[model samples]
Target: CQPGFFKASASGEMCEPCPAHTERLGSGALLCPCTDGFYRAPNDPPTGPCSGLPSAPRDLVATTTQLSAGKLLLSWTPPEDTGGRTDITYSVECRRCEGAACQPCGEKIRYEPASAGLTDTKVSVSELDAHLNYTFTVEAHSGVTQFAAQGTPRADRPPSTSALTTSLHYTDPPKVTSMRVDERTSNSLSLSWAVSPRPRAQPRPIRYELTYRKKDDNLDVTMYTVLILEKSSVQINDLAPGTAYLFRVQALSSEGTPGGSSMEDEYETLPEAHLTQNNTAVIFGAAVGGAAMLFIVVVVLLVRKRRRNSHTRQGPEDAYFSSSEQLKPLKTYVDPHTYEDPNTAVLKFASEIHPSHITKQKVIGAGEFGEVYRGILKAPGRKEVAVAIKTLKPGYSEKQRQDFLSEASIMGQFSHQNIIRLEGVVTKFKHAMIVTEYMENGALDKYLRDHDGEMSSFQLVGMLRGIAAGMKYLSDMSYVHRDLAARNILVNNNLECKVSDFGLSRVLEDDPEGTYTTSGGKIPIRWTAPEAIAYRKFTSASDVWSFGIVMWEVMAFGERPYWDMSNHEVMKAINEAFRLPAPMDCPSAVYQLMLQCWLQDRSKRPRFPDIVSLLDKLLRSPDSLKTIADFDPRVSIRLPSTSGSDGSPFRSVSEWLESIKMSQYSENFTCAGVVTMDQVLQMKNEDIKNIGVRLPGHLKRIAYSILGLKDQTSTLSVFAV
Candidate 1:
């Protein structure tokens, strides 16, 4: 007899099978036992299945230990009613309170002192704030952080809140004064400040904090904080080259009162190293491995200044139309040998509009640096057209102001329908703003999600073609968009998709930024190519790989790439030759193109021109999508954590998919609302395709499995509940 069956009589020829939720191990048993986390009553039948869940742990006790002021210790005994199971795990939640209204204590605020698989009853928690109250709740759970914060799914086990008010108190903030810049380097700054009337006199101690902001901002517009325990002077390193920055120090008291110094002078960060990742690196007339490539031309950006997302542009400058460049597009592309000031280039090409020309409406969105508004742009000689105006946030330093408008320097040069058009900019007035055409549909990812299942595959392919066309244009002009994801692609009400956001865009020029770190500086990992991620190699090929991810996003109706996998997991999987599975209902040809884009060798990847041509070919021939692409089991033998079904841990729909080596369709099943075994059994050939299972082999495999499972179970009762 198998584990589910048992011997009922002393000399019986065959064994009887166990009832549901009951099992017999090692055979020859007279009576079957109840399953784990289940029970049997005294008068119950010997073969009856256990059907009860485990009860809550016993006597949950919470205490604030004397080892630390904010540290909390929790201890609980075994549950009086364990439901006869030893396989029990516990999850905990901590909340900070202000009187009756207490919200969840964020992961950043409270320090968790237990592992995720906390089987132990006793846990030590280092608690949160000084004046605010806090509580801890322990419950039996399958996982942690479920309902730990807002937006998480509610757990089956109800949470109980019981907390004590904090005893810690604080006083006025210590005054920090005479903050000044002491020394400066290309990549570091030394600053010193004095704290007047320090908080040592009070019972609670005070600490000094340092922060700095770039004149030219990075992707993160906020100032970074560096904690200094009562120190007066400190050095802030890893600053960008050739940019300006301001530093500030604060003497923050225990009560979180900020005693900050005035913002420092805008000192120029010196240029020492030229470590930048440039995709268009042309070593024109330069001695190999020598210092011959830094020469600047009047209309070119030949200087390799070491800045991430460098505030530089290499253009075939309209040198002849210096005064009239903004009025008309340059007919001919010419690269002259002279580097003009980036500020002057903005003045020359980017039309500076008066602040009065733009009228602000409601706030539409935001950028890394400021609030974006949907507004009206009424130039002197042009008609009133709707536009998106980006204004500099208040309290911006001069350098930040420069970096914000510098985007216009690049946007002003491009003249393409698929690229976001720069209407003009206003840099001279007190209110600095960069204006562009309003995109009614906003980002492609969110738009696709909002309108999921509304667009046909043909229309989706058209959107991809438009993006490809824009990328081809950029590639032709020698610009590499390192961060080309669906989110960066904007769409208008006309459904025209345009490529926007050049923060990670690089100049394809002679001798690309010569210095780089191996970690692929600023290039997004999941969307980036393997070579680019491991070698910091930014090229048109890298952008192609990103384009493939965008295609997947569009096909999946904006599903997150790689599902819920982490960056490390994605990197490991890619390194192991694993690629993202095809999206449901994705055209076979389109998925093939995505695979081509994600090829291991950069040279083998299709060029943007080729991509656009391929997209055009597909658009011209609609039958290409009818032959949906399917996965081959032989191809996915190397997929992570996959094995034969002989000793599988799970036997559900997802489990069956994993057993058949087609678990990538788990998301497809979820999206199609196919969760239970009944749904899986009810699915037919057309039903599989309707759920986005485009892989022909996958469709056959699932169909076969459904039939096999239905036959084995007879009545869909075996492993179907």
Candidate 2:
């Protein structure tokens, strides 16, 4: 008797073929186990054919830099209905989706480190063209030989693995950084800019675009652009003398997609009198007198340098902008740790407020240490100002009280329009309170969501710019905001977003790498960086990652980061190199900045200053956001919607399968325990096959129906169908 045959004779003389869905491996067995993602219900008899559990390996998250070869990094999770088996592995497939046509990519496409039949759920694909989106499919396959004896009806057996798809959102190479006028003559200027560092693996060419236009409000100036390759700076040989011109530089991809640009700056070419060449005669006449003057000027410069060196005890903020002292206003910060007593530190920065001056209105929010209220703070001779008041709960321990007041000590040390102002602290009263300027519009995230569609792309980017400005100020202060997020940003009626909620902020003093290590409290998994989450290293880089999430929230109109993924899953995916996909219709340039903020290497992430600059450029040139980030971030793109109109019962995967006349496989879905539309949204061909679905036509129909539901819900993986 063969492995698929069984003996059904009292005398053991006759061997019969095994029934459908069952297999006998030893050539002559009484019965067979389920095969190919098949599993019988607990009550089913041993003699019956096995039922199948539907499953498919899901490769949902993707990352790319829009490299010349279009490298794509993909990550997936184990299939849910592993058919109750632990021997599951995955395989990958590539499909090129562009301009209304999505077809399987052939051998011409390349997959780094091998493309198929692997245990590790990550893969990198290369050799694809940049600036275009592509689709990918990952399937879950159980050990074929290990389950060789198990069988199902040849036509009904589901494929071992399913296809999981998602969108790949990326941008062109980074824009030029540190752009400035190197030399400006009466009729010419040598414009220079630096390109941000790129990975060695970056095969694409980074082209610098120098755009210039006369700064004139009276007439529309003709915008001139110079495309430069293999160089960071270019000399614009021709310009009107004494003309004030606006200049900006940007890096372009091979496909001509521009990332963010440099801050639009203006510099007037030196007047005609300053131009050189024929001025040698005049110079020679003055040479005799100029020598003495030059000598005196040199001596004065040396004396000033000596004086500056003698008083070189400036704060970290000075060192940050030392090369360009006028770039930022000088602000002094007295570290709270300097004071021997916490109370002394708190009082040094902020004055104590009398309880009578504070009138509580109503509760607005709660935190770990206290309840917050929107209230009034009235100082003598000043008008009553609305402010947010935080009160220490009555039952809080002395330790809790100190921890709560510690924030006041920190906030009071800073002064910036984007930074929340610390009004005053009330410690003498029974309930100690911290007062702050009230943000009429409330938290940025909720506020954006409340008015999602009402904001334009420019307006939204402005809000992000304000947040970045605040973060820049905080970063310059050598402070690490461990829990930066849209929720931590407060929006005022004027739509100005300021950094607030300093509960998780700490000073990273003297850390060469600008990092702070701590045993610490809870980390916001979704908003935190990989290094910060795993190694407890909180740094400005980590804050940048959170800021990227905040950017997503702002672009998505306050959509939650890593939607529908749990904390554990979010960490795992992030660790696996998966990042949050671009928001729907997000501007390509804006997404590019967000991608830089989320670089896995903490040191590689851009600084807040650079981020602020990028946003500034985008705001100056609103046309930069015209090109949208393109990707089918929702579920499968091929499936059709079966769920009825608005606020329907939310169709389950089984019902959709039934609607498509594929109800024969509903039992497989039931066996797989797939209930929601989201679960089915990610199901691939192999997943449907593994669940007792066989036959090309059936799989195709089901696959199309499943993927077409990409827009059916807001909960599915951004890359799945």
Candidate 3:
């Protein structure tokens, strides 16, 4: 072995104790193996007895430096000696303060071995208190014994303070980042900023003071418009478009101290032409590409004449459509102007109406607004007439009453058979009561449930056709029923379905075709279209989407689509384009039509006219609806065809012979040649007597099966008349 180093034996040797911090493992007469945490220097004498790890550091000097985000980084070197051994491990320790007789630093200190190149050792201490003094020490150990390194015991350091302050000052001045028109009529532009770095000592929240100047004049008279206290964003209004302006920003410290002015970012106010859709070019590209393109083309042509007429006629409609979109708030706050109870407002409207010819009766239905009652009146000398009275609850404001009146006015415009009739309104009462035609069966959901699936596929198709006709009619009148669902559709005793509840409906006479939140508020998101849910932006396409859900409800006998899903989960599913399954007894073609309406791409959805035509076709072929029921998704359809003529069950012996004997052969089967048992029963008595034709029981059974009318519950029998 080397002069003073040797292995004790083949067995693992126990380390021999040396002075203070020295250690070495030994076997037999050989010296204990040098312990870890210390290294023997090459300059040490070869014959020297193993000594305590040459003053393995008990304390290390490190100064904490502030990095980004107010963090203190501590770095130090490894212990000097490995107790006269090559194998060594070093550890680092820290404390709150460094002074003589300072106790072992608490658990705050962390230790790591110097294995990889210790070349320039560095370690970071994160999440330190800002601008606070800290003392750190490094302790080195050789095996079980620990020693201190020769270094200054006090490592006085503090976290770096950010140069950024909370007050607004300018060595230079704050400048605008970019400027673009939001609403041309509103003349509003939103500005944003890149916050400056905050000092560790005083972390500052970013605030903005948006100032503006007219482009034509060069003056320091920059008018301060808005003071945004704790945000990087601000919206300024009352500025003329196509005007040049300058802007500047200053950072502020947490203590409300202003930092030196950042270099002013010079930006000119963009003319009305510069506003990308929703003030975001990226979101516009993703969500509103088509709408943007169409709008851009139209605005370019309209811009020249726009200055002549300052009073923008399109502003209300545009604002209504745009305002309903799902705008994410930059920060959370409680808005004071919240929606009020619509039903109470409607009732108060009823109390105000002092009608000369008013009539009320038994309540037919109860809605959010109030109750609907069946009423009749025989004015002076006129014949008695049936009317539905809708009385609102009390506590509605005048604005709510007017809004209800406006909704009633729109509902009054409809006169289609499938649309519920609205006669007139009594606004003088404390609450308003709208008169209309009454339906005996109430809502479609209740109507269908009462029928016990007794309505044949044909009848159901007819009902759907009626609903589609009403929708088409409304579309023609430029009206969209924001809440189109089975619950809002009433059915008369004749089983005729009529669309009702104009509380959430809108007449796009002077408005655009989009969804709007009424004074009542938004409808349940479960039935709303994806776009409407995402942005509160509604269109005829969105109405079509809701109608598709209604169709599913009707066919499913009122089972909700994707039942029991929370709004957030439903949104995730919808954004992923998950759709409701086709209901039992729903014809593939009809279901396909509904799916077309529910297409994720709103533009690809079908118009009401197309939906009407498709429903009509399905109605004509009632058998198609039955055919749809036979389709099982879990298994492939293996329906046997009865079209072939090979003397099999698929073919009738008589029809096969007739086809074979025909001199002019044809492979196609004519609808005329095909006969059902019902046709045979319709034969004239004299012809039947002359022919003496009698159908055997088995033949009758076969005929019934062929006709697709074989019922498991009913036994077929010949009538003896």
Judged by lDDT, which candidate is best? 2
Candidate 3 Cα lDDT to native: 0.52
Report the poorest 10 consecutive residues by lDDT, candidate 1.
328-337
TM-score of 3: 0.38
- Please count the clashing residue pairs in each candidate, in the order shown: 17, 29, 67
TM-scores for candidates 1 onward, in order: 0.44, 0.46, 0.38
lDDT of each: 0.66, 0.70, 0.52
Off by over 4 Å in 1: 1-341, 504-520, 631-721
385 Cα displacement, candidate 2 (Å): 0.9
Per-residue lDDT over 475-515 for candidate 2, one digit per residue giving the tens place of the 0 to 100 score: 75567778787877898876778998885332322222223
How far is 698's C-alpha from truth in model 3 (Å)? 31
> Per-residue lDDT tens digits of candidate 1, residues 1-721?
6666787677747777787667657766778776643455544566665544445666777665422124556777665554444555776777677768988887544333352457877775653445556666666643222322233234633342222344334344556767766888888877776666632335555676565566444331233344555667777778787777756566765534345444444566678875454543435313433443343342245333433224344222222122231321112211111225556757855788988889999898867678999999887887899999988899988767766777787677566668999889888888889899999999999998777666768779988998998887776555667778898899997577999886422321122232133443454666888888787777777899999999999987886677545567678888877787776667889999999999887767887879999997886566787777774322212122323475322346687687555677899898888887667878889989998877564576567656555454332231122
Candidate 2 regions off by >4 Å? 1-338, 504-518, 635-721
